[model samples]
Target: MERVTGVGGVFFKSKEPAALAAWYRDHLGLELEPGSEAVSVFRWSEPGTTTWSAFPEDTQYLGRAESRAMFNYRVKNLDRMLAQLRADAVFVDDRVEISKFGRFGWAIDPEGNRFELWEPADGL
Candidate 1:
């Protein structure tokens, strides 16, 4: 049998796409994709895997009920990332979850999309 290797990319609709991309670029250090301000390429040099998952219909983990998906970004430091987001006055979830897999934090983008940040545990 064959299996999917990893998530290809995250595509979503934004009302102010260019502004949103710029926000991500300025705040999260994301780079704009070539010839496109509304698209970004989040390239990572480290070795890791992207997870594909689905939540129950009634689950609230993805924020707005109308939202069908959320983007999860892997980072080097959860604390520092969250702190910068907070200092930028972004809407960050008060809760941070720690598990054997890694540490997790969440924040709402300017477009009101809740996104996740993860700092993998050692060897993950």
Candidate 2:
């Protein structure tokens, strides 16, 4: 039987969409142009890339204790990505770290929601 290959898009609610979209473009260099579609699709560089994750509602992963939301991005450079976000003045939470899995980073959206960024280890 045929199975799911990868994620098609990410849909999330935002309040200051214009600023948020611009932040994504300037900070992370994402392809989220202003006046574009609501859904954003990120293509994987390598094949057969799939991941599973879970978060809790209270003190789960991020600072949000009432709501839980997380997402991962396959980035080429973790340090560089973090640097970019920092340079853009994005609020990055660096309280979490791992040895073998990958680097974990986060930033709250304009609507006060938590989002995760993952830069997996080589050959992960």
Candidate 3:
């Protein structure tokens, strides 16, 4: 089983999400969907490529983050991947969530950066 396939998303905190998004739009030319408050999805050109967005500074969606950014990695199997991490003595969180989007799990790196593991919903 492939543990991690590719990066699903790159998330970070922003004091002013709209202003930062506008900067990306004007400077980087990232076409952002209008009227999105906290998140703006950037879809990949390749099929099955996952989306990326930024969250508000106070958002708890990424759990406790010592850093301003987090990385979401696309996984083949969240359970197996987490199990492997635990077997290697990695600090894997016990909480796992399943939603319409997909299954999610979290792990802390040696340097204490939090990262997400995602098994995307079917056909996503």
Q: Please provide, for model 3 over 1-124, each residue's C-alpha lDDT reduced to its tens digit, 9 standing for 90 to 100.
A: 4569888888888889888877887888766766674455656676566555767889777667547888999998899999999999999989999998799999989888889999988865
lDDT of 1 by residue, 16-97 (tens): 6677778877998777767776666444455664543434455577789877678877777788888888888999999999
Q: Provide the RMSD of all predictions against the true structure, rounded to 1 decimal.
A: 13.2, 13.7, 2.0
Q: On a 0 to 1 TM-score scale, where does candidate 2 land against the true structure?
A: 0.53
Of candidates 3 and 1, the better by TM-score = 3
Better of 1 and 2 by TM-score: 1
Which candidate comes out best when scored by lDDT?
Answer: 3
Instruction: Order the numbered candidates by TM-score, best leading.
Output: 3, 1, 2
Error of 2 at 112 (Å): 1.6
Tell me, by TM-score, which candidate is best: 3
TM-score of each: 0.62, 0.53, 0.86
Candidate 1 vs 3: which has more lDDT: 3
- Local lDDT at 34 for model 1: 75
Model 2 Cα displacement at 87 (Å)? 1.4
